[model samples]
Target: SASETPGKAAVGEENIVKLQHVQDTREFFIEVLEYLPGGNLYQYLEQKEMLDEYTACRVSLRILKALDHLHARRLLHRDVRLQQFILAEPGDPESCKLADLWCLASLPRKKNFMVEEGRPCDLLTAAPEVVKQGEFSAKSDVWAAGCVIFELLHGHPPFGGTGKALVQRICCGEPEFSELGTATGGLSDNAIDLLRWMLQREPGQRPSVHECLKHAWFEGYNVEKPSKQVWQVEKLIRHVKLWGKPPHSRRNLPASNLLASKRGIVTPGFCTYMGATSVDIDFEPCQMCQGVLEVIGKSEEQQSLGSRVWYWVTKCVLSLWGREENPKQIQLKVCVKPGSPWVELGSCTLDDSTALEASIKIDKPIRYVRISLRGNLGGHFGIAVRKVAFYGYQVRQIPIALHLENLKFLRGSRLHTHAQDIHPKEVNARVHKSLQSSLRVGRRIEGTGAKYRVYEDICSGSPHITTAAETPRLKFPQGVVLIGAVLGLRYVSEVPSKESAPPRLRIQIVKEVNAGGDHERRMKKTLLFATEDLTPPSWKANEVLGNGYVDYPVMFSTGIRANGDDRLHLEILFQNFSGTAHVPADLGLSFFYVPELQSPSTSEDEGLWAGCIQSVQSATVESVSLGMRKLLSIWFPFHFPRSFPCDFLLLRFYILQPYILVSLT
Candidate 1:
């Protein structure tokens, strides 16, 4: 029968099982086919769990050929999965044959092909269109094949869930490909690109079986194992072992571009490594990017995607002491996440003679790393680590200070120098008018209505004509936390325009509370600093206002949360002292949005999130401004909660060499 089939020569016959004999009986018809001793690929995967990049590529290449053969005859193997493929030989994995063809269907002449409603099939391998609109075509088979290939590498299907939610995700979701393998069994961009093409939601956009075969993922790809596998961390570290004498000095180091090479352990700065008994290294939270799944419903029990999963460590470089009489063995272990088991990353020998630089290439990504030293007795040297580096998937955080021009408060008209023209009564009247207009148009401002009007006019054109300066805005990838800030300023005694006036600095915290639809309320807290400190008898007038630094304590008992629905704003105003503490004329004003603060779920989570054992640190310092003369710098340290969805936070702005630094501990 195989010999009689037409176009059998064109389509590789070896990829398919040969139909041998058939018998006809009165009650039933029996057929016989070639037998292969090896079991199906699904069984092989069950035994091996997962395949390396080379083996996976080899198996995928043959599966594509089998699919190509079937598609050439305009036939659809509706069920395309690992279970449908049988291995031709026991030991050889690449020798796969397409077996079950009972679900095969001929290609329809119509452009649109629809399957029966509620038909039971492989849900995991089913395409989006098939699950949504019941549309089935040859491209649907390609989608199924891609899923098989994905499972082969990652050891699981691209999408996981059950019931209606799984169906919804299949219909409207993209696969998570943050984890994929390359030619060396590491992350491969080419593989991800190919998968994107094969798994396109629109069937027409997907490449044909032939086009998939021609993709660059298959180029220069062979079944032969790599001469030196880069994914084997043990093999990479084993080569640097030397039982003899050390080199002259610590001159021969590994490549400088490694993860921990020049960059310090916590951040990109200098680090001093001391020889200690035991040491644990964790990456800085600010260096990583994070994402959370969109909550589908407001209910507490509603299921939504959690924060993104990360296994940042892939390759590592360790610089250790090279020469010693009794060398100590180091044990390397990695933890995938908190509470997860620590996997052994293999041990290596180290000495204190010459500088030893060992590059360990890991096949898997790890989150936390723990290193222990063995063979160290009382009075013997412990693990002497010079520098350690890592290489893997990283989403760097944006420095808030570097992009200060983008802040909302920094963008607007120049400082208002004509404070002398408007009387206090006239200013109050204008403030009242602006407040009435904002209420009518559904705008909310905490204090100083005129300043709010100016900000509103610049951001969104309003009827109120106000001057606002233009400054750059920092675009965040996702919602970020505001931890803290620091400010620096220069004060002057008397203003050039106003003869007897003295300058003052005012800081305000404004929180906008939203009560459901339409209705909203504003809460304000203000702190003022004056430069009326008595000058020393020997000091001159100019010397008193020349240079000074003051520490201002900002205390709030309750937490503040800022989000799209509700917001918290920090505003700073420079004004001339009006003799009394009641009112001060505004000279210039600037404000920006601060991060939302939420309480932790548990006490243990609070400790982890706070990054310190102390619950609170408090210090009181009196505020004294040297009469603002142009210099202004801010540095605020905002508290970041570990349980929150924020990946990184930044506080940055500049004015006349003034800069703000936001530090997260």
Candidate 2:
């Protein structure tokens, strides 16, 4: 009201008169009004030390009757406050009338746009919808009436603070009268109960103004006209000035003095919200120093504004290391920007409204952050933000590593063949037989000296020197030497050397002559030679004399005759041979030998008869050593008639020489 006329202005004058303009609908005050003047109730409340219970009830009843009449006429007073009430006469306790028609809007005017542009109405006396959604109805006015009653009893507005804070408190919930202490004393129980019901969450739940008038708190109160007397406005103004402004102004002045004047300490911070009745704050563990700071709000409950809540903190940081300079305190202020998406989770704001925060520990430090909404905001509409900062320490980084292992080598022999004798005794006997018989018969065998012979004619060249009647009766030497080992060797013997009287032995490899004719025969008359030593002493025979003469005649035989008692060592080697193109189905070793037997007749009467024959002893030698080339042949179940190279050598006395081999069949 002071700002409307323009003067030095009260502390909150600019905020009190901000108005909105709409389509004009003028009504003559004198024609519609029934009462004269009561002056402003807000100013009257300030001047009076206190109102008695009976007086407060009487005043509340008049306001209710007026509102009931307005509701019946379908007129809504969108703006109602202590300032709108006037006195009918000076010093008249019960004469009051509602004023300020500027904020009124018609019921049939579908859009009540006038209310938005009227005066900067007191939020403490406004309804929840007016603060939250800017919607107003007759029920909203009832809520305003409840606030006026609270103010009348308390000597101040029900929830008073920054206009924003009061709005937030009203939207959230009504302020408790019990928190007003002595200011709320002497109020009738029915009066307090009706006030609370008017502030119910749903507008439809609130009682009509006519129903409020019938409340028990107004039992003895009358709505009839009282005496009208002209009141002097200057005298009332003097009375109001003597009582001073609202208690909030007086209480806040001392705090303002301390903050404005204190040099060394950082001043405590404050915040305001749109629809809240209180501004709750916690300043314990002061943001700046170790000392605690005090917090004040519009209501003792510390209500906050329902829109655009503000947060503030004070702190000091040492900028230099060694300089003893005055502590520099700075104020950090942040507004809770309100929106649906930013509902309060938790915050340092003591009222626990828009200021939201939950205990969150970022395990790792981060930078350049952008936070998006994660959950609901407790059924409210807009988002709100105040301030955020990390307090204690700095952040850091870390590192990593790895390892491995290695590799290594593996171990294995190649394949070979060595000669193993299958029938040594038979082989020795065979050698002796061939040597002795070949010496006695002196015939040429087909395989004895020939390099190669046709398959069918193997035994053809052998001397048919003796039939069964002319078979050899020979005396063999006691020992024989085999100089070379050869596969297919069958028989051998020792005989006298022509060069001297001592016996000479010859070692021989022999195969039996098969009886079948050309078509059935498979043997070839070829002796495979492993060596070329044809000298005489190299040929030798086994020591068994009877075994040497037992078989049919040996084809070739030779021996060595040296000094007395001189021994000779014989070495022999054998290998199997076959044509490369024809791999025989079966191959084996054969040994030819002779056996000694008694004469068939009694000796004295008939000439002594020596009957002899060649016999074969089974021999199988898998490994054999050829002269220079190693060849392996199978020699197990059956004998394979094949030729291979042969050699013989005699070692006697101090001399070592190649033993001559005499060819035999």
Candidate 3:
């Protein structure tokens, strides 16, 4: 090729040219290539001030096409910014080619890669979910491309601020051409529509690169009308409804939080009205936090734990928006029912300067939690909470039928006033405090016909499973002996919060049955058996606790039942060795039943397993708070495919927290 070119010419496997090392034989060398004299998009934009609308459109359209090509090859150009846009040919803006593959990533990457594949830690024109959870895919590239297009049309980036303001603006605000004086700026409605679709806060809602190319904005004269304008309008209405609304404070998930039909539409941001209300002032934009409960007020108005039993609120989170006029002092309390010698569990105070927090933790389960606020020198107004979340379990849900019941309370875990009796009535008069609830938190909660999801088994370290002796002929990955079908169960906390997370603890898995005769029936039936110690013993004393949540995995023997009773009475009993931790009331567990493999049949070649989902039926989910942890188990009759290998099931894990418990500290 060119004799003066700086970059090397490949020589196949022996493709070594004299790599130009930095001066004086330093180890690092640079790959020199023929200099691109045309200059990049940033330089062009600086010289021209702003690109013409058609030229801008053409550039964006070309970039999208190039991106589509990369994405089709399962690659992601994550940093699709101005610097990367190079002239495909000198002096031709229409032929711009994207450059600077700093953050380029291969598609469908691992979820926890953190800083691999050019995923920048800084928020440099990325999607909301990317900023929120380091999640990226082809759609994420589309978002950055949209941002570049926006910057081209206007003279600057759409949401230009520093620090938290920049993140919030990018995540929550809708930039409009109307804001840029659309009449004179002259961006077509189709163009605006395409940009808006690409920049949607929710990644699931955004269009694919192919879909973007098909949008009316790119069609020139063949602009296509959107198929469902009503759907778009409804989405906009939902967004509007979520904002600027008065806080019902202390209200359950009200009508506004849910879509009317049973469709599986999960909207973005916090619509669920959980937590306490701040002062009731009429404001233009809803002071509502995006994904948490609002808990700001002058006087005491704690959340009630419902009219039923005791729930251990393991964690509580308080996300600050900003204080109103009077927010100098903050007092938080967790106490039992009101009486003399008031049974107080814990109390903490927050000053204005050092008050910012993502979560606040408590050791015990208490019915009442009271928050009070006072203002500082300059102003006097109520405390204004942006978001508040909690985690805990009800006392009655523990099912301490006989041996597990505690007649005497531990001194430190004594949020309960009944120091001697476990019955609520004996101490109900003294323990009538406030907690979240015993009712369903979300409508799509189990027993509502929502499809169950298969979650990966979660355990600290590399804990292995041991099955009871039954089908000793069968085996599984990780030395798991086949008993019946091992139920892959994962716990879900409703109001999952960092502070709300209980300390490290063990959970006992047991199956109960009606063993006693009809009239003379006893309480519990031991239909389930464990092959070894209940909790995995390999957990180290100095185990690294997560930012908040931990997964306690349990495996049960599923072989004994012969009556075709698909449902098993699986009971989760939390071990109280660590008094500092309490199971959140919002505890949820899901199970996917996998049948045990049978020994080969009449034919020698007949196998024990298959690849299909035919053997496994519907997965079951039980919410601890709603008391349906046992009876409402799901068991669809789907079976594993008739013929396939049994050992191919690869276990994977997923973390899905409820809407109300997002941490913003």
Candidate 4:
């Protein structure tokens, strides 16, 4: 430690080395303190790669003690980095000791004064508030310690960037362990939990030296005795494989981690709850891939955070879209803030017949967004934007209808109904006639759209993704289009008897006559379900009904078509009767739908406009009457004049004559 004042160099002047003429001209003093063995932990880590969490915790505890000693004496080591900690050597764990108090202060100095004094606080390990507000306290030391811990556990600092960029990132970003799981093997809940606390951006949230020692990470360690803690550190390091080990073969699976986020380059926050350790992840490639900025529609759900909203997303132009017979209805919602009750921002009909695609914009800022659409895709949700722009802190372009996994950000996809977890099993029950034939393992069947938590293949039941996701939407002349699929199935009934067979469910959507006419008949032409096989059984839900019975939730997805006429809807049906088993009890199917189908001639009205009109919203004017399978039509004449004050094209559907109803979108 050295300072302009000899006393500050070596308190009490016992080890102060007067190395120059001391006068107003200027002088330097070097402190000759006690000599101890051991280089800093930073250097040790360079050679060893990483330390076991237990050892890291012990080291952390020792460092905490050092801070406790300094803070107890009203001192603050503004810079507590790995390089500043001296190690007596790996064998002598207790030999670890703190170094460099040149920048130490009895109390926090003013921001202006600290700058003038040339404080040596390490910017990378600097407390966020210190970086943003030029402040430091006991908590600042904790933040520095957290940085050291992060390096010990992950081999690098939590944030990356150089100079000003580095400084800004540290001030705004949350610490993340991108190398969580397979790399660290798995971190101790206590270790990660404590690390999060230490790296808090708010200094007040950091724990005290006393609290650090009391952390769960030091559970089996003896903190009362310094020697005991050292012994425990070594003991824990010897056996620390914090989480379960990943099979060597499975280690090569893609790092199913986040690709980008304002939080960190890759946020591994999802690993803890997602059971992502053993699964392969293919993150959606962003504009970062094409090198062209895109307004991305992520398939993964994003956690709501206050990352400065960057775009208002005013316009979204979709192409290769679906629904050939009629215009598709699309709805978009955005969450301005986090949590419940999303706001519906836009809802419009997409029809390519008139060469006008689906595009809308809102001149406002939004935090989170979602889209629920029903259209006809040749088994895909084909959609790409010629242009997608949003205005926010800054206007930017992004992607539309993207699917991403991991704890990145939120973007919903029609392929996101989400499948419930499943495990494979063998049974001898007699399935209904629909599935009386042998079921194949590799074949796929069409059903409903669903989101999935990728893991090993169900056929092999290992830690690797077996089947690649089917292409829901490719490219279309109209706009991007994709059929939806089923995500999960929860059957609410008693398990079929051992001799009873589980019914096989094959799903598909088709055109139906008016409800009042031929209401009980099944249609033949499939619109959504276009496949023959089904999702092979993966996991079973047996926790509910005990014994030999195990229920399961099957995941599925399919194509879509507009259910134009209210009476003419789609019906989900299947055959049954293996030993006379009851139907799936309350058989219910969840599928996507688009409203109103317009013929080419009927849609032409959208293009007709009055010579001078203020605005033209979608207006449909028509009148039809139906009763007992009988249909009657009547055409109404319009008074087309400048003074015809109305926005919509009126439509009057007289179902069974007099029951009148009005509706608009």
Candidate 5:
């Protein structure tokens, strides 16, 4: 029913004829295959409204079988639209044959064809990867089949829009189902599912045409017989009815606007052609635009709902292989219109050794264009345009902690002592006075005249010394002495002996104040001491009166005495601290060993018997003023195990004043 005539003026004098390639295709069919011409299914559907299920199935099977044959022969009918099929006889539907080989491109002779990735194309009926990457195989044809099915079921394509918008929707939006549902009175789920499978994004997921024949929707379909002859005749009639009329005359229009004569302008019409030089032309303009000209490239000629168009421009260059001279430059001016923004859009200047590219966008449409070379040109360099499309933007999310400042070790001694003790006198003067006055006043008013007050106390004592008897057993009468200042006690011991014992000592602090007639009482106890030896012993205090200062010393002397001793050894160790902060107390203690008088019988000996204090120090026991409270226990060992007879061991303790304090932020 449909036939094509090229170079003949049957329709109109100015009617555009099919390109030579298309004409050759028609010749191959008519002369070689002896088949009459046929047209597209679009016209057929327009006239009949819709095809019966059996006819639809027959048509689908025929198309698929034909596609399989083409693919097997390594031939690709790139434009697989419904408009390509044609009818052979005027009224015989069974005479319908495949037509419009204009868009067909000979595939590579070898099995391998260079496939580019992420090439943009028509999106509506195109596979996802085809739109993303310009990579395709025979499976791509199956995707076209899905589109064809969609059109058959409905009146229109799945996704329909302008060039850019169509591409956008195809790449980003889902296909419309409402139209198909309405046209077919609701398609079977199996049919819908088959269509979806055929249109999957991945090419490998699409079923082959042969495989499609097995689908449930195509059940009982016949691929050999022309059972849908009436449908084919109707389709041919529709085509003749629609496009059979002569093409519209453009003679009344401006001669300059004619498509053949127009330069740098694409008319608002559809044009399909086959072969490489389908629409090639050259132009020489009097003046050139200062801006850059952008040209888009098309992978295929058929326009689908969503297809991206890419464009590029280049300059011509020439070089001699054996010559080592400088290359000449060509000056070229190009202009691009303001239109839709394009990704990977930019300008480039081509020289002998370098090429540059940039991305750009246009806001308005443009028609007339010109380009000028910057310098003398050896060859021509021009801009090329094509559609480059992509699917979607790749997106990738990445947790983040803030605020940390300082850290320090807590040791109490300025010297070797582990426990630091705070003396009653070192307490915050204000707090000390207030506490002392309160106690003094309270005690005085009560008529109980207490000389000192007990405020805060802590004990740091050794557990090794168990009994009072063992307390003085390890004491050094006239040698080095060890003291625990924080514990407010000294370990009294001498050279090991059968009767030597651990020290039995306790710490007590006294603060004297004038009572007067107010009869007030003030009490403050800063340090406390504990002894492993719990038994009570006779308390003896030795006072060293010097320069109007009274120093009281408690000595736990071992009964054993040594003679001719020249040196003394002392060792000290600290355990742990334990205490409370009600009353601020700090204890500091020192030890001294005195040598006993030499016997008159040995007076002739040159050795001297004397007591010496080699060092002094202080440590922290507790500091109530700084909110730091601790108990420190220390152990001290002294030995003067020589044969020299020693007289006495002197132990001294002092209270240090509190100084620097730290506060939290």
Candidate 6:
């Protein structure tokens, strides 16, 4: 009755699972099947609790189709249960298919049933005959399908408990029908009647799988109701049908409640559908947009001011679409909140090649952005948008002073005087002022005691990192450059509890040019290090940079540094990147500073300095040779001379041969 493959089913039917390959390793056989992203019906039921009568009927119809596929031929899915039905699409109930065919058994040639010695299925969904005796047939699977249907309509299985008590219940007891109508939704009389016929304890008394498929419930027969209520029910079913269709074919499907984007980040602002125009919201816009909002208008009336699409996005928003014939005029508007007057963000006429890129300067907190279409030209088939995106940007500040920290230079009382000389109070105040001016706060981080919103994990009474501590300043000498830096950092915590937020260190190297004049002064920053909560080997007892110190070396080959005209500023900031709250970290310059290449007084300083010089020299040599190789490769006609070593050897012979002859004569 079915198209046969060697050891697999026809699989032409969508309800049956496709067996891709069979591998025999003598000991065991491995059947590689199709990959299904959606887990199983059991897991789906656990998530959804119970399906509504309408949704349950749809699911039961598919289960019967899968059973009929196996039953048409003499095959029986002996272990039919909720776990066997795998969904082709995740979260879609109608995408279920019969996947587990390992326990498939054939009916006896002369008889309708076969006797099995072992129990392959659980006692809960097992048929009465299968539990009492070892006999199994197509009727046993049908009985299991009935249990699944009951569980779908109700939240739990008909039979409960385990072991001997469960066996006695299934063998002799009847399932309780209380809470059937009130569990998921009001169960239709047709649904109740179908359940009663399917769960007829005796195998012969139950309807066959084909007869169950022809039931009045699946045939869309419901009891007579008021005309208005009946129309509403039909409308609801129609809406579900439209949503179930493919994306391109779906049209005018009602507005959906905003769900989290595929990235799991729910973009700010509630999305509302307005006007009579047709629009589609793409929930999974991978890299293009957080939420891809598309609006389409069929007629000129739909393009009027009354037909506007309003959406909420934060930061810099880029909205673009494929050019329709005769460019459409689009007006963009923005407001801080709903009911607030909208500020016009400029209107533009767009062509096929032009794109709309608008940067909304978030002076206050912007909550909504509205886009309205207006145009009177040829080819009025509506506008189609290909992509829309919203993102934020950060701006760093300019430093006024130059600083270089050498812990070897700052020893004992010298450290105290240097700290006092910098005016810590003024520096801290300036740092705080500059940070507040640049950093923008979101709506969530604006209210009283709202600093914790940014640092949600950090608790009250934790160490506050409100200061951006500065090191002593030193001017660069004429023609001298900054080679690199070595830092000694140690973690210091009074509270040794894991509940506290981990410390983050941000070390900024700022260079200020022409510090004498306010007009000519320009600052450049180099972020030397930004650590992400790194744990030290051991915690230190105090704020001193002595014990439990770890050394960090930062080197640059093609060095970009400050000259004599510029002053270097080293600012060490300790704060959580997720929040502005600061923790304590001891930072000190580990190695001695060498302004020029000179012999070291101690072997320890010499080894570290020598290593730095060696690295810089090696980098310079490699860069010079690489440049020469590239020049030779391009200069040669048709790239004839490929090898640089052979060319060098030839050049050496010409110069040395003439000198050797003159010496010999």
Top candidate by TM-score: 1
What tens-digit string does per-residue lDDT give for candidate 2 at 100-200?
Answer: 55555556556423335344555767777777667778888998988887766655555555545555666674565642232223344666777778778
Identify the candidate with maximal lDDT: 6
- lDDT for 44 (candidate 3): 81
For residues 311-384, what per-residue lDDT tens digits would candidate 1 score against the true structure? Answer: 22446666554534122565666532232234566666654446466555553333345544445322233334
lDDT, candidate 3, 251-324, per-residue tens: 43332332211111222212212322233211111111121111122112111111122223444544554433
lDDT of 3: 0.37
List, in order, the clash count of every candidate structure: 34, 92, 38, 64, 110, 5
Put the candidates in TM-score order, highest first. Answer: 1, 6, 4, 2, 3, 5
Model 2: CA > 4 A from native: 1-38, 109-120, 180-184, 220-665
User: What number of backbone clashes does candidate 4 have, counting pairs of residues 3 or more apart or in separate chains?
Assistant: 64
Candidate 3: where is the Cα deviation over 4 Å? 1-34, 88-91, 108-124, 181-184, 221-665
TM-score, structure 5 vs. true: 0.28
Tens digits of per-residue lDDT, candidate 4, 1-665, equal 22434224324322112223322323643444455566667767666556555566677777787777666655777888877777666644445777665566665343312322344457878877677666767888888888888877766678865677778788776664633432223465777888888888877777887788788778853333222110100000111111113222212221222122221132221121122122211111111112112112311111111111122233433332223422255566643222223447677765553333555554332334444344432222122222112221121111111111110111111111101222123212322221211122221223524322211101101111111111122111121122233222222222245554433333343444344555475454454432221222232322211211112232323234333222222323322223232212111122221111121001011111112111122211222111101111011001111100011112111000011111110
Sort by lDDT, best first: what order? 6, 1, 4, 3, 2, 5
lDDT comparing candidate 5 with the true structure? 0.32
lDDT for 213 in candidate 1 is: 94
List CA RMSD, all candidates.
23.4, 54.1, 25.6, 27.0, 40.0, 29.7
lDDT of 6: 0.44
For candidate 3, what is the TM-score?
A: 0.30
**Model 2 TM-score, all chains together:** 0.30
Worst 10 residues of 4 by lDDT: 228-237
TM-score of each: 0.36, 0.30, 0.30, 0.33, 0.28, 0.34
